[model samples]
Target chain A: MAALILAHHQTSPAERLKDAAAVAFIALLLGIPMIGLLTVDQGGALRIATRWPALFAFVAACFVGRLVLRYALDQWRARQLARDQADTPAKEVSLATNPLLNWIGWVALGVSVALPIVFAENRYVVDTATTVLIYVMLGWGLNVVVGLAGLLDLGYVAFYAVGAYTYGLLSTQFGWGFWSALPVAGAITASFGVLLGWPTLRLRGDYLAIVTLGFGEIIRIILVNWTELSGGPNGIASIPRPSFFGLPFKPPGDDPTFASFFGLEYATHQRIVFLYYLILVLALLTNLFVSRMRRLPIGRAWEAMREDEIACKAMGINARNVKLSAFAIGAMLGGFAGVFFAARQGFISPESFTFSESAIILAIVVLGGMGSQLGVVLASLVLVLLPELGRDFAEYRMLLFGAAMILIMIWKPGGILSHREPTLRYFANGGRR
Target chain B: MTAPAPLLSVEHLTMRFGGLLAIDDLSLDVAARKITGVIGPNGAGKTTFFNCLTGFYKPTIGSVRLNHPQRGVLRLEALASHQVARSAQVVRTFQNIRLFPQMTVLENLIVAQHNALQHASRFSLAGLLGLPAYRRAEAAAMAKAVGWLERLKLIEKADTPAGALPYGMQRRIEIARALCVDPLLLCLDEPAAGLNPRESAELNELLKHLSRDEGIAILLIEHDMSVVMNVSDHLCVLNYGRKIAEGTPAQIQKDPNVIKAYLGEEDADEMRADELRADEAIDQEAVR
Candidate 1:
């Protein structure tokens, strides 16, 4: 029996060598145009220069990497085979019980709350941190659809757009405050989520992704073309900022703003600080709702649906309702974050809600790990901060970002925090208590 | 002879897939709290019939009627797949064993009680707010799941992922998961497929206990003679999409059609010819 298991895992040495050769050959083929060829301009004419040294180095690296990886894999297989023969239990990592990982999420949360205070003098850092929090909120929202429900939503930003535009139009037209328009924006965006979900509920995986992608495009296009209501391409402007309850976060004007009411001198950083805390609370609420929902029966059913839809159906789980709830709830949270986006910026455009935004949000969720709430927080920080850190490499920022994402996938295909904790446990054993 | 009213009545069921006639015009009645064994050759449409009866497949033509205690009589084929399990209380296990693999064995059982808990949770609002009532209901569900795990001899593996367990344990876990549905009629497709002799023996005892003590009607599909012959109260045999024999185990053993079906027509004829060799010789002499 042990031999049968080993036979399945171990590859012949010849196959490994062949694979290494293929990697080297492909590297050479692609390297010719990429690393080897460089475009140079001379008197308005472009000429290609052969960078043979760089090309050879790239090919040599690919060859060496493949050989080393294949050897390591072979050694691991051998070790696993020996363990199987010994009938020893394999190791499993669970963040719920792991000594180091157990409190990492709480630690990250604490640091995030104190970040603005640490960099109180730097507006740029606080603003970037606010952007990161917005993404953290969106990642949690999209995690419902992609992580729990196993519904690949490539167009999640449409809901974000709906919330932003809802606030943008409503505050400018009906003059609703941020607190008043927030729920309305969420409800409308959720309705839009259902509108998209109802017809496409039957679709799954890539097909579902395509339909959602189209939905996002349709929303953006309509917002851009519908001149009368959406203000066409220019978008709504001067959306009112959120107030401190009723007191405005502005200079001491005729109406006696927040600074005057408290008998404090107005500082430009105060509004930024207030906005940062505002999103912090919202993002925390989003995380709370997702984590709480994950422990519920409906939440378990969502994860179960992701694992096996047919089994869920056989168990009397109403898959249609479960999936629709995931879509609506995820979209609703995205909507809340969008409302905050419009209020903070006081301006909006279709450009803010593009396919790239959806992709980035999805990347954060996947990079965090499907169905892992803390993973989203960690992933949002990496995805948002990485590009900021790469600011010096301006033109190569995206390239570096892509390379980092690929490296992460190679290291952990299931995401950085892929360990799943049981929603219910009968014994306080290896599983989560 | 008049018989007791069946807990389930499947009538004139026919399922076709494009050009293939998977199931012919078949009909059967499963009695209350009795184990009915369905045995058939490969591709004889045993699982197809179960799927049709359990509402997994909408039969090309037929009605599957279930006599539910609280919900009254329901046409199962008219309902969706989940409705068959939910309202009609007809639960089934797959031939290949489809447990929620990543879930703990205990979680798998609790998920089976999703509808009941959902109702108690007030559509999740109470659960979301962490109300005491929802928590009580959840604890009750957990207790029930633990009870099943204990009874199934799986309490030790309760926290283990269902997929990580041995094959026999996984099969039992699937059955335990089905039981959590409060099924009025339990359908098992090849429950003994992957089990060793000892596991099969334990399964027989479990099935008998469930049918006798719990009074849950069971429809078992099996090719294993030892299991089917010993446990089944009523046995039905099918060949080429038609019922060849159905009776008590003793009667089915002596059933001529069943014998011919199992041993091809030519082999049976050859065996009878050898037995009548002397008699045929005497008849030839009389003719002379």
Candidate 2:
């Protein structure tokens, strides 16, 4: 106790005593179960040992540790204050890292594409890489709604489900191919997005989130219960896989299949590689489309509406059209990804499009910086691969995931990359500001 | 002063929020290419009147009209908020500044011309393709934004995020953003509210230039006596949701009702008028 007070600066005895009391209270909460109680076996009989000395020792350690930490922090703050006063005029430090970060983004893109080819023999790595791309696509799609537009959509998976189901029904019922049904599926799902966004124009924040959540669940429940259209709980099965344009990936024949056309032996790995490239192209297109939109008038209006909706209206930017456009475009991209998803899986059910999936995609967008395109790729890799790698942890996997999310929030509260570059910059060499 | 058929006319404007009537049967006309000042005691429905004319709040009873040169005689009250700015060309700034804080000062101005640029981009299709047409419109928009930034002495801070700027600079940015809308009638609610005396003096010059040289009608609501006196061509005073007195600045200063309203003299109005009449008689005797 004397050492605790002597090392500190400016803290009164009463304050030091209060700090000790608070630490002691916390010690009582943590120390009792951890140190005081011990389970033991005595000749096949269970006995509970009361380790009061150990508990007291734990409490003392906590109290001393807190006092020392407080003393060190106070000393550091005094030094910081003196240094601030003695400053030789403040100098401007440039945060001019956009060009560097741009190079890194390009390197990441290259690595993502080369991953499957580099690990060709390792099926686990290729499969996980494919899964990461799907999530990357979904994250990019939801980034438009949640990040740029600042609309909190909890049920984004509804559009994904709509696209999957649309393609499923079309290919099975009408015999339309993946290439043909892709645009149709996207259009239908976009209309569904419009249907959801239209009535909720007046709602924002939590109310909008609740309505979207309800919309997602309503779609899932309908897929589960409506036996006619969706095949009820059984779900649609044996949906056709996407073909390589005019040729199908199958065994060689006298007629030209994919392998026979190339004069190569048939292999399932080719189809997997083909599907990997398919999503890569789709996700790249989605990124291109969104990045282009971000520079345009409607995109600026969407962001401005997020910043200040009343101000958007005052500036003659229609908040309703901007928000609805955001929803539609986001849903359209999600639908595109869904078409690829259904085609890749060859089977999907309502279980695949649950609220948890929406939450994960949204988590990817937020864990990335909101409104950042490149951040989505980084966040998706972190989220999807973390869980895949954590498969060895089994039951503890989710606990690790939650702890990582908490740590990320503590470390970078805005996000991993919250720095925003305005769409229209006045100067050509404008990075510092 | 001669009024040329009025640019904006608000007839019997009354705005009711719940049980409280914020504005009551207020009628006023704002002249074209002239600065019209709206002043009153605090909570005198000055902001509410602006809101009604700008179509933010639909008046419970009234009609607001704006005479656009090309798109003539538009009823502002019937239009939506965005249309009131875009179609009728009647723009307004807020009492509390509402710049898009996260956006750069120049981007804030660019967003103000959203409707025109959105149209020029052919509904964003041309924009996505990066067509030359959209580029031209965007370049024009940038030129306009840069011009305003230079005029407001904010060209140095053009790339700074708007929220990081000082309060007075943010106020100038907001006004500059409003000017980007190409408004025929600019309604400014307390543009001088947070400005220092020097800033208010700058604001006075800007308002005069915008009204006279730029040929935009200005409806200004200000509490700063120096600002209102320096730039106003016409002054209207409000008292408790009703128009108390209105005329040229000189006439409004001498009006007994205007003085009584500001002083809150309940029984002094009749007594004050008689005293003015007695003073007038002494002046007449001195003249004879």
Candidate 3:
């Protein structure tokens, strides 16, 4: 149908010329004041100077450029018409279910595992990679709620803050280690998830988002005002780092440390490298867990509820339970990521768990495509690496990042990977029924 | 009501929506192992009745009792929407065809059996661990979905998204999905609205097979006369949220109240004239 319209609306050469002439006239009208007339500083006095030649050249360039651009567009459309006519009718295949995407996932996994080893000496590179993985894990967590369950959560960082504070306070006040604190933090965060989800389960769309946004801010405000518990904006510092199975990665002390037990020289970079590998494993486990859950009955229910809540209720699915489960599980994952963040940085404050952090995490999930596990990896890389790569363009970093995001959204409105895959197929062995 | 007993009975069902009375104090019985057609004009409250029975809306003053074979008598109106299907074994399809558009035909069917799978999976713990019990339950669900797809002649499109299928196929898919719920009483809303004559005929056969052979009671709310009149063992006509008439299809067709409700006062006169002309033509042919 679109091709038919394109084919029928072929403009005549006379009309094309007239179109270019009208564009040039408008350009001249605007260019006269801005380009033709310029204010020049004449030795402490300002004077209006005329640059008619430059202005005419600019207008002439616009006219020619418009004509060429139109001609090129017409030619492209004509080619598209020809191709569309000759081609077979396109069948709607699930684009995301391609075997090639699975292969890409495997290849990405391989590279992520080998990255720290290959760049062992470059702490900067490994550090940046670790950041990317952290975001990837958070993206997967948010994907469960926003992507699979279709809940627009604007305050996911609240869970992250809860997880971090759970660990920070436990370790700082109670002398708890990372291993023991991890589960406690995750459980607490999951409970918090349910707490927030209970009241907002009846709300949906924009209202739910607003409540979540306020939830995030409320957590931050609590963390700030409750100085006795949270250490206020001054933040908790010198939090204990995780060890290698009771073996601390410290300079060979009286006790056998990680380096001493291995009979190798101790280096500060050892801990950084260990942190990178630790996060890598955590992110992979998160990926496996999320992907496995996607195939489970609850996961399918989540996706179904996302598609249509009323239909889900009609299908005998308890809408409240499905939504609450999604929130709890998603928050649990986010909390786990938060625990790791606190351990790695060895410090955390309300300033660190801001709304912008939630926005960036949500952005990664959306930009990756809702419910696509592999897309999260790609999106996290783009989101994290863009800023790191833009460090040299200091002043323009934010400007470029905004522009890139806009371009991506315009190019793929449904996210980078929009198509959905069925959780279960009748043909498990890839044969038709 | 030839069956041993009616599967579902409604008493004094009334639904008021703000200033509008969607369903008045209406009552009807649907017999087991038979197709009971609820025929009514637009805004006659047929859908409102289905909604009330399905627990989508709380009746102002009424009772919806479902006589479950195993679970004894169940009060449907008091239960929530999901409980209506889960415990009472009463499921319904929507008039506007609400389907998970992104899910495959098989997935949609499988979702209908979520309660069973969820239980066997032990609320997803066993499924997450990939236990044998969960696997068995999942495989059984897959088998059930596949069976319905094959029976509905939708096996070839099982992998296709439900929304992408043609209107006729989507209607069948909806029925196939609803069947997966293992409902004792299936209420279908306008199942033949978008179907062609041939498809409608196929639907008639399917509905009969389901009610008579499968022994599942079907309460069909349809606007297609050819479908409702041909397949319904019993018919109930509703007008202005009131039960105007109830009898066999043959008797209800000749009911004066049903005719007057269907064709207003003036249209009934025109319909009588048309019927008279048709009778005269048949008489002339007999003379020849």
Which lDDT values do the candidates have, in the order given?
0.89, 0.88, 0.90
Query: Which runs in model 2 stand beyond 4 Å of their true positions?
Result: A1-97, A430-433, B1-3, B266-288
Per-residue lDDT of B1-288 in model 2, one digit per residue for the tens? 854798888899889999998998889999999999999999999998888888888899989888788988999989999998889888899999998998889999999999989999997999988899999999999999999999999998887789888999999999999999999999999999888999999999999999999999999999998999889999999988999899887667667788787775775575677767775775676589
How much TM-score does chain B earn in each model?
0.92, 0.91, 0.93
Evaluate model 2: give its lDDT: 0.88
Candidate 3 chain A weakest ten by summed lDDT: A1-10
Top model by DockQ, which number?
Answer: 3
lDDT of 1 by residue, A279-346 (tens): 99999989888888888898889888988888888888888999888999999999999999999999
Q: Between prediction 2 and prediction 3, which has the larger TM-score?
A: 3
Evaluated at residue A26, the lDDT of candidate 1 is 86
Residue A374's lDDT in candidate 1: 84
Could you give candidate 2's per-residue lDDT for residues A39-151 as a string of tens digits? 89999999999899989988888777777767666777688778988874773333244887799889988997898789887777877777888988989888888998998
Chain B TM-score, candidate 3?
0.93
Predicted complexes: DockQ each: 0.54, 0.68, 0.70
Q: Estimate each model's TM-score.
A: 0.91, 0.89, 0.91
How close to the true structure is residue A23 of candidate 1, measured as C-alpha lDDT? 83
Task: Compute the lDDT of residue A152 as modeled in candidate 3.
Answer: 97
Quote the positional error of residue A346 for candidate 2 in Å.
1.4
